[model samples]
Target: MKLFYIKAALLNTMLLSFVDDGTILAQSKQLDDNNVGLYTYNPSLDLGYALHTGTSPLKPKTYWRYLGFYFDHRLTFHEHVRYYATKAFTTVQAIGASSIDCVVPIATYGYCLWYFNGARNKGAMNQLKWMQRKAALWIMGAFRTSPTGSLEALAGLIPVHLMLKKLATRAVYHVATLSDTHPLRSMMGEGLLKRAEPHARSAALMTPAMLGKVKSTVMEVDEHIHTLTESFKPFAPEARPGDRLLDRYADRLHFDKRNPPQDRHPYLDELIANARADPLTALAATNGSVPQSNQYQAASAAIIYKGHRELERTHYVSGRVTAPDAELNAITCAVHLAVKQANCQHIMVFTDSMGLAHKAVDPSVHSGQAFSLSVCRALQEWFEADDLRCITFIYVPSALRWDIHGEAHKYVTKLKVRVGRCKMDNSIDALRSQAAHSVLDSWSSTFQDPTYRGSEFLELQWPDGRPIQPSYLNGGPWLSTFRHSITEFTRVCQCITGHAPIGAYYHRFKINKPHSCTCGAAFQSHQHILFCCCDRYSVHYPHFLRDIALFMKYNPKAFGFNRDPSGVGSLLRVGLFLLLEDLSVN
Candidate 1:
């Protein structure tokens, strides 16, 4: 018996060494063990168990893990998925035994069954839809005590498909950044490029069947790029010489700007000619009527006429306005000047402001009754007098109108600075102030204690002053591998605000039988879940805390916990939220 134990120990040691040295094949061949397996999907192809090692053959396996990725010889992920699904189900059952009754939620059970039955058979989108449905049902069961309206209030959680898409997009970007001579590129060859190429085409060409086949990260990256390009096509110019080479991949295409010639529109030629003839006149002619009337001390108007080669002439008019309607006054002034000073019969009036343009053409439609009456009369008088045979109001987009409008804006800004005179009644400042207050009120409501001094949260505010909602903060790198469900993040928010459908909150509404936990805690609050729950301490609670520490270590600022000891509560709340999501089976 002693000799047999020693021999077994020696064999185990030798096997470990062989595995470390990547010589498992040699050891397996020497043993001639029929139990040695080679997993594969293709039964027709005979990959002899031990080719290099001179010994008896080893048996084949149907599935195995290689370099962190699950694989099967048949190239189908069915077996691989089933293995993981079983492991996950077991883990969930072990940890949640105390909380969930023997009868598992139908949704959770169905999700487990899917891994063995239909999950592998479906396409990516269909698979994602199945997971999403399961997720929604799981959330409903988890927060069963919450009101239906309250549950509905929570924004739909980021789906597993989207998380995968984001990761895949990032992976594509990483690959695209690699040098042309990188080893991975050579190994991938045309297979990688061919798979990604379909995503580079226009959306019209990307058929549903073709889209369904896009399962890999590379393909997802391509699809995102294609979608973005299509959205920006109107703003972005068509491809030019050398541009195609620059856009070898989706990432490259995102940053590739059109050549100078392509960005210049044909209308720009007329505007440029008009400007070059007389810079001052062109600036005045293109300027829009001021929006305000009552407070204006001085007003200015300009007009430009296009001729065969250059601008015929520019007309600039400046005067004081006693009238309350400044916009109407400016338009009347410009038209009278154009008819008197310009040579051309057909006149073109270019304006930077869309409001002014609308009022100039049809004042009765968009302007106030008082302003409309005056502006319409003036325009009709000019046309009847033959001051202008034809007048066209061309509305140039802001980017396209930069040269004309920008110059006018600069001139006006300088004049206002030098004269120290109040220009007009501008309501933009009042509107901006109102918007800022609204954002502040919304943010304040999120924190139970309004005095919580954490500048980190403030840093996440949008340019318009509205706080970036927690839903938008997809847990950076730490949470990247773990996709969260909608209810999970919402729970975090509820925890922080003390509004969750947990013990006391539900008990108060008569939804639950008791406010106290099984551990005899006075109230089963968010704090109890994180720190005081005795039932969860052994497995669920400890694991959750460890995940929180890991998350803080990975990205402290993402959850507004960085460099602030006071933010510990916020950090734990977010951590618990993430842990619940990580544990939940999609």
Candidate 2:
């Protein structure tokens, strides 16, 4: 009974090993793409994956421990040695637990490959490798502390648990059950799902630098995200001033009965208006009755009614799958297809597959196949450009999907594939390929539909042309493309003039170009342009420069040759970085 309790504790605690509790790491809002693949964080996407690693009693005891426990279970020489091993492992893992990130191994692997620069030059790699090697030694050193070398068998087990829990959380369970009724359950969910993908590579062998970033960022939220709600309150109309939600966040939120932000509208009102445009009645009229079973929807009716192309970038994507390999190969294939040609910027892919996909893609499992994170690293490098940013990969819950679909179902289906003859006795190759079919609807871009028969254009170009990514753009780097476009015209305004562009330069510039500098110090030519630009007058120029750079990357026409000096309608805060430290008149 004591042995059973120990094993049981190891089982339950082992799975929790990967959970990161120190700080909640969240991705940027830029990742909410509901494009071609079923590639997202849907509750159903985890079904096939869940069966593989979501198994209860996730970690196994060492072979020696099993035998030792079976023979005598405790306090004997053999038992003490095992105890020593366990204690050493626990100490090593505890250090790793406090200092390491669970998702790091995969992230680093993929990241290193991305920056390999055609395998030509080496950057911080030697140092990073040294750190990793030392970390490995740190782990190995635990054994020296073990009085009996008999504890050696437990050498690596604790690190495994520490990493796993730091990676996945209880929330992952909900993601595991999205597609409970899908047909792929048998072969897709367990036993042999990743068996077919003979080339599915893991993210480790590809990039190491990228992985390091994931490790660092996985521990904390970004500063930009801290201000997200403050920047968006203008569009939300759900609550009234005196009513309450605003009161709770009185410090963080700045609205009141009479003093709402000048340009903001309520979210509830916007939703109501958007709802009007696509009343439930209208959707029923066009598409028969809408399926209540589907929980996913585009932006809410109210927001959609606003007639804007606003999209939520960071959101939970999910789907249900029962097919073998549907969880791993399908999403990975979609990422490959989407990014191989540069359809989007960068993409990060994560899995709890326990080397299943790693082995499938390379047949390296057991045969000494290692993870190759090349694809993911390439994506990261592409995102690092001034034009494109970074793409983060996250591993989420694939079971306990109860909170996902509105149905509130608790059980996640984790069936395994039965390798047997079917009606056609298709090869695993064919089955895996079929499993990788894109889950996109007609609107999808990357994952091609298995049911596609090709649609005819009315005249090849309608008045409103069919939305298609320009074929040329597909080959461009996604990170650069997104970076140049994201902040292009999105920022609020000129920090000085408060101008939102008009016909030609404002006449105020032509007439008001002062004979002497506005600061009354120097002549208003190049000298004034450099020395006298004050915080009150100089703030907007930097913002203009930033926006201009974004624009120039995409539309070179916007990169004007001339620089102008105009400072109006702005004040510098105490710590404006653009102002030289000496310029603060205060």
Candidate 3:
């Protein structure tokens, strides 16, 4: 593919090729005539090639389909959007929980070409939005009248426009990872590819970068991602087998989760006693904390002990540090201290975050790679010093609050240090996380506004009683509960959307029928029925989701259209009379 790109660069015409099939784009009419019998395609007219065998010419299309994207002479891409939108909508209907995978990529295929390039995409976006709305409705079994925003929230679908923005932003990041000698690199100015100084203004905005009037993906990435000095690592496939950083050093590092602490102080005492028994063993506990009140105020602390006495303790407070960054920093501090200790053979590291422990040894190009690389280098020397010198990382769940680990955790949590005035540089991962969080905040805000999600949309809360925010993480909060049963899921959806066949809903639609409950309430409502209505319809206010599920199970026809209020009332009276008669007989 690189060879093809290089070859195409030498030519004057625009060549868009995918594998064996491709299209040659040109504005010259005579070029086609000049080729004559050599080439069968007519550039002057829409004429397809005729096979050499006794066969008719293939039908000429107004637009060409190349690389799964449709394009006409004018580059409208209207047919492409329409075709894929319909295809994705149909595919979404049959797809289960993974409908997002099927629809999003299909609908937004080649978006960088048309959408991110800043084309007049109102029509295209509308088509894509329609596709997404249908998919959301189907996924949640939501009524047609349900607000698109709420349905999308419950269905775990990002809005179409935002999804495009996210994809385009990620594509920009990908371009940053490309080789310096790549063709796209030449189009981007040198400033974008250069590593940013620790505390300097962004090169993207400070210098006149691109000659083009429109902003390219490289410029966009530069605006968001600050390039690090160690950003330009060789691509993964370029490395030879067993030559990768992780492959060579992974054996020296160990992650031990066995013999986990069942309780707090007792288990912690045993661990400390075991370490004290071995005079040559060094024990280290590290913790990192990023408080919710202020994400920028991150702190990492590590405590080390040799024999029966504390060897050293260190903690650093930094601004704009992510949880992983802080965690890796703590690990790095612990590793550095442990390796420096005299006569240390076996080192035991206890951390609340086991994932970050593994990352401390990872060689991937990610946030906190600098810290990880430092720890790996230190451990490499420590292990090479003596054959038996090894380290084990043990998982200590923060909830356990083991004595040593808890101390480190507490220090970081309550550490007070003046943050430097100089602005901190965020890693690519941090920037991406910030962007995702911003998108979620926007979604939550939109859902909260009655004008957007409609007043009737049910606001659910997490088990902790915090209001549930929209997220694709773990299949969203609402649908994951009743997703096992389609019928139950549909009923829940209807109730939340206020599109169920209840009395209030009927009255709102002007059905010209009674809207009162069996208990003679003026009007039936979600809150009224769930709390104030008769026994069958009543449940506690701010009820547990489990209770809601049980309520639906016990009163199967509570929210269904099968029985009206009068019918339910008659059934209740008849059941009461039967109970009385049975009691008299007994």
Candidate 4:
């Protein structure tokens, strides 16, 4: 009995060992499968082995779908593309069977292509283009419609290239932000300061020049980071009274009141009437009348005096209107003049130009415009003065109703008219002299006899009675379709530019021995390549005719092919494809 018990115990020990080994093996296999799905530099060798051996617990044929993106054991999206293609076709068929608009299916497929796979891989992009082409063809066939101009237009979708570019730009902007916890920041080793410190010890072992290069690199990285941070920093509201008033004016202009304001203000009509009745007297009266302290003025003054004493506030500025560059000069001049005339801490100058007003408020925008460097220098001088607390630019409506703005506008307009007259007189004199000599010799001159018509002696003339000129060589129907390979597209462009690699051009450059075609044509020019009905070129002849037919249907006058069939050869020479079916023949 004791011997029997010993044998049972031995069997039990072996059984327990087998169970533990199996469990460990299964857990390891699971780990390998999990690693295959991860976006790691190196995946598990065990997973690859399983894939090759076909012994993987998770089948090799099975695809793994995670986080909306699909992949197989090899991390390829081939199966994902196949699945979407089928889905798109079925959706389109269903939409066709129903009463839904045909545009719905196109839109649905486009949305799927963009959002479903996020266009994360080249395979996805290819699949998107293929599906779009198929969908467009299917829709046109179902609806009995002619082929649309371009692929995107036919599908009623944004171009795939543009969409991808937009997404890429957004990703780059996100990666460039200056957050420590950002994924890109971590990927780049937490930026220059941290990256440089770790390599400092290693730098001492290098040559002096190499060490200097390393130091310079570190400094460049630091400066780059600083620039990016400054560029992306959120703009704060300008503290000046002028900017605040401008913001208020902008808001009022875009206001959505229930009782909408009239298109024309009553005060404008009254001002117009006053001006018409007595121009000189009205102008004098308007200039003399001080603008009543309205809500805009009161609000501006209140904000300016918030931190200063009542006794310190002295000067009150209104507004001005002038030319584009003159406006900037006027603002600067007005601010200085106000400060000099009345010793004041704050001065506001309202202008009729939004562009100038924005430049004054935003330093970055100001720096990029023409003549900004000089303006900045002037501003720097004013800012340095201890008494000048702030110089601001506010926007005001350029209307005759506004008395101050009207007066400024009158003076500026008169000055501009005077300058314009002087420039115009000089320009007219110069243009008149050039015009006399610039007339073409072909142009009909009064010196020529009335009956000495040279064109009547010429043998060639347009059948439509329209005068044929050198300008016709440059005119043709605009090609609305460009869905061809780069090589073919380039050939089309060359043909249009009159520099195609035809027999004649190649012979001129010594690429070919003769400029003749095998059909015994004189010169294998663009006209011969398009119009020659030789046995070798007969296959493409129908396609050329079809293109011409389509061109005539849409644009008759553009090519004038209907008036003269001979001009069809010229039409074909100007970038229109000779063989529409076979793009490879280009």
TM-score, candidate 1, is 0.32
In candidate 4, which residue ranges exceed 4 Å CA deviation? 1-57, 79-122, 137-151, 154-158, 174-180, 188-230, 234-262, 265-586
TM-score of each: 0.32, 0.16, 0.77, 0.30
Tens-place lDDT digits, model 1, residues 1-586:
4553454344322222134454332123433331232211112324443422324354446655554345555555654444444443454345532222221232122232223212353543444444333433344333333322222223223333333333333343344434344444442324334323323343325567865653443344454332111011111111233322222222211111224336445655675576456422322244422324323333443444333333332323233322223334444455555555444344445454445645443322221223334434444554556532444444444356455444443443233212236332322222233334443344335432333312111222323334444231333221232233333444443443345555766666677467776667888765566555666434345556666665556545544432333555645544654343242323
Top candidate, metric TM-score: 3
Tell me the tens digit of each residue's lDDT in model 4 across 1-586: 4553453343212111133333211112354433332212123555555543446666333665444445565544666665665576667666641212343333333233233222345666676556655654453331112122232232333334434343332233333333334332332323432323334234324565754454322233333333222122112234234543234333222111222134434544464354335312111111111123221211011111111121122122222111343454454444334444334444445455556545533433222222233344444454456532454443445653354445455544332111222211111112222232233222223113223222111111254645432210111112222222323333343343223445665665577456776567877765455445263344445545655565556555543333244665555543243342243322
Task: Please state every model's RMSD to the true fold in angstroms.
Answer: 22.6, 30.8, 8.5, 20.0
CA deviation > 4 Å runs, candidate 3: 1-12, 15-61, 101-103, 117-119, 174-176, 182-184, 194-212, 227-232, 235-240, 244-246, 249-251, 259-268, 418-421, 461-466, 510-528, 531-586
User: What TM-score would you give candidate 4 relative to the actual structure?
Assistant: 0.30
Please report the TM-score between candidate 2 and the true structure. 0.16
**Model 4 lDDT vs. the true structure?**
0.37
Q: What is the Cα-based lDDT of residue 284 in candidate 3?
A: 93
Question: What's the residue-level lDDT of 9 in candidate 3?
Answer: 51
- The true-versus-predicted C-alpha distance at residue 287 of model 4, in Å, is 25
> Against the unseen true structure, what C-alpha lDDT does each candidate score?
0.39, 0.26, 0.65, 0.37
Q: Tens digits of per-residue lDDT for model 3 on 169-282?
A: 666655655655555554454455444322223233344543345544445655555433335343443134565445765665678656654554566577779887998989
Q: Give the worst 10-residue stretch by lDDT in candidate 4.
A: 298-307
